[model samples]
Target chain A: MYYIDDFLALLFGISLLIAFWKVRTPLFFIASGACLTIIYSITLFFISETKPVQDIIFYSMACLGCISGLLFIRVMLIRSISLHALKLSNTMTKNKKECSIEDQLTEQMTSEIGFRLDDLQQKGFATLTTDGSGQLTLTPKGRVIAQLVSRLYRAIER
Target chain B: MDTLFIVALTTCILLAPIAAEIVLKGRRLQSNVKRVAPLYIVIALCCITIGAYTHYPHPIVIVMYWCGYFLTWFGIRSHLESSILLKMLTTLQTSNLSRDELMSSYLQSYSTQSRIAELKNSGLLESKKGIISITPSGEKLLSIIDLLD
Candidate 1:
């Protein structure tokens, strides 16, 4: 019995060590909880005096172990949720303004529908400079309205 | 000798998890060692209560168990934290940023230039033109961080 216990304990210990060294976050917590629970239980065997007290103590330790494990898992879940929310916010923020401008430009150039400004230049929708830049930089009226719409979109998104 | 071996083995088992937790928690947050010590106390209390009721060994044996437990905990925790720090350094080394940009963004350190230089000298990173990259060994170290993330 002792040998089996020792062997299992050693195996558990080595696995725990490997988990630490590898630093795999998910395995790290699981391995830690397992090793701690096993070690506590085995060590208790050598220390407890009365059978009733021993049983009670072991049961409580098990409960504590379960709670600790649950807490660690809870923290992990919260961390992942917060990270996801941040990523979503960042993506929305970066694209929100640009998308609104694209929409407004599309609306103003109704004749060039389904065509990019660059494409329109290629199809002679507007003249081009020798350098191939578009002649019509959105007029101040277009620019101002586009900017306002973009601002409104951002405000609504937020 | 058998008793001592059992005691030592038990300690290792107990401490491994605590060490792992410490490392994970430490890397994610700027927590103090003192703040995390309570978890170990709770584990120790559990171990003691069970040990006392089951067979009640000598007080000295019990002390040895706790000492061993704490020592293992500290050792593993320190090792894991250093490993994580090393991984972060390796990632910075391999990133496509210029020395100044790398320092400002990923490294978030004032002395990132010197730090990158140090890593290069240590053979953890190699630089070409203005681009820096992690070496194979550095990549292996960084693999740990990648796995964690």
Candidate 2:
């Protein structure tokens, strides 16, 4: 019983780490959560000697662990996908031992955060002008997120 | 196993940040190590004190509770400091822009100067006479990442 929660938490963390790197889909996260739920239920069932309150505590902590792991993994994956730092490092490799970018992102900035707006378009945050003018309009979902982020960013800056 | 102790533990985990923030408000609290130490010490002392006081302390569960608190704090701090998504969304909030314009605007507004400053501050990259070079440590760090990826 003493070592079991430690083992279970480790198992859950490994499951989440695997689920995240396995694919881009949300299904894996859901599957990992489901697996964790099953593990928790089975473990609690076997440790039935504990009273109802203790069971509640155990389950509550297990639930928190699952949610925390899921959220943490999501944040980490998003960070990895950004890869701006990697791009900068890659750009530095061009000039042998030294380099500089004083002009256009295309010229010397390497990727220059060449993060495509198609990403936002695919996420439904931005829409292209049909004439191939490349102008973007924010979707309602995009507007909502933009508003929330603006507020949060302002608050943090303050 | 004490209900009150568990409740206190959870409450402390959640509320410690509010207390820390209040302490950090007007003064540019430089030593985050010191800021974070108090709550951690309090939690540790609570775990030990509870064991002595009630003689029914669960070490693993209490430690998990502490982990939850620390991770929660870390996640919030990380997001506030480095969330590109948040910064991007905020950039988009101001105006309707084209693909090229949007990317360039974000890069101009936040990415270039700040990233350069951060990289330099971290000692990973250095600029000498307008030429930039990665330090040996930075090269080592990138190599490790190359291996991992």
Candidate 3:
């Protein structure tokens, strides 16, 4: 049990270090988990007489750590979804021409906007034309893009 | 106190992109999901590390964390969908065509049910006597679009 605990600790420590080194934003969660661990370890080390306190600290840290781990998984899942959306958009754009405004918009969207029309459509951000054709129409929600672009233009002008 | 401070600082950093997006471009918060996931993951990972070291054995913690994460994810997804619908409607409003013409054009081009659903959801258009017209809320949202000019 001692060896296993040590191994887990080492793994977490190494992960924390890498997170810091890579400037991984997710490191914040890991760091939080580490801090909880440190607190528990310190309580166990210094408060040997206070068994109840030790237990409480141990439980609290464990709870926090588990929660953090689950959150990390969720974040990963969201990232995967976003990546999948981008990939789908890229694949859709890749098969088409790029010189026209529509193609240019699609290309700019996949490359710069990091989203795809299908994803938007599915999400209610946009919709497909009803003619059983591949035509895409921006939904009202998509109107924000024009607003966002105009804002950028205004800022640049300023 | 220390933990709270760290958490607050971290949350602020994590939310920076959201603030920037809203202020800089008036984009919906959901649009930044790809960039924001890492921050949430980091926070989650940190909690896990803390839990393991604390030696607390409770499955409920993990469940709660995941539930919260998924809730936030879905919330963002819903918001993104709404934003897209809002954008399309605003574009149609600005075009040179009449409301009937725009509706017909959109109907001819896009799925009517989805378009109507989006409009209804966004509070942009109301249906009465089988006709739809822009609502006050819709006007407000569209006003933002005009402000872009």
Q: After superposition, how far is residue B46 of candidate 3 from its true place, in Å?
A: 4.1
Q: Which ten residues in a row have the lowest lDDT in candidate 1 chain B?
A: B79-88
Q: For residues B18-114, could you state the per-residue lDDT of candidate 3 as single tens digits?
A: 4444443533334334454555566556555554555532323333433344444445433333333333444443543333344345434433344
Q: Which has the better lDDT: candidate 1, or candidate 3?
A: 3
Tell me the TM-score of model 2. Answer: 0.66
Candidate 1 fraction of reference contacts recovered: 0.00
Give the Cα error of residue A144 in candidate 2, in Å: 2.2
Docking class of 1: incorrect
Question: Scoring each candidate complex against the real one, what DockQ results?
Answer: 0.02, 0.34, 0.03
Predicted structure with the largest DockQ when compared to the true one: 2
Which residue ranges in model 1 land beyond 4 Å of their true spot? A14-35, A38-40, A43-158, B1-110, B144-149
What TM-score would candidate 1 get against the native?
0.28
Q: Determine which window of 10 residues in candidate 3 chain B has minimal summed lDDT.
A: B57-66
Residue B35 local lDDT, model 1? 53
Query: lDDT tens string, model 2, A85-116?
Result: 53465565654644354333234333524444
Whole-model Cα lDDT of every candidate shown, in order: 0.41, 0.57, 0.44
Candidate 3: where are CA atoms >4 Å away?
A: A1-158, B1-31, B49-55, B59-64, B67-71, B77-149
Better of 1 and 2 by DockQ: 2
RMSD of each: 20.2, 5.4, 17.9
Rank candidates by lDDT, best first. 2, 3, 1
Q: Pick the candidate with the highest TM-score.
A: 2
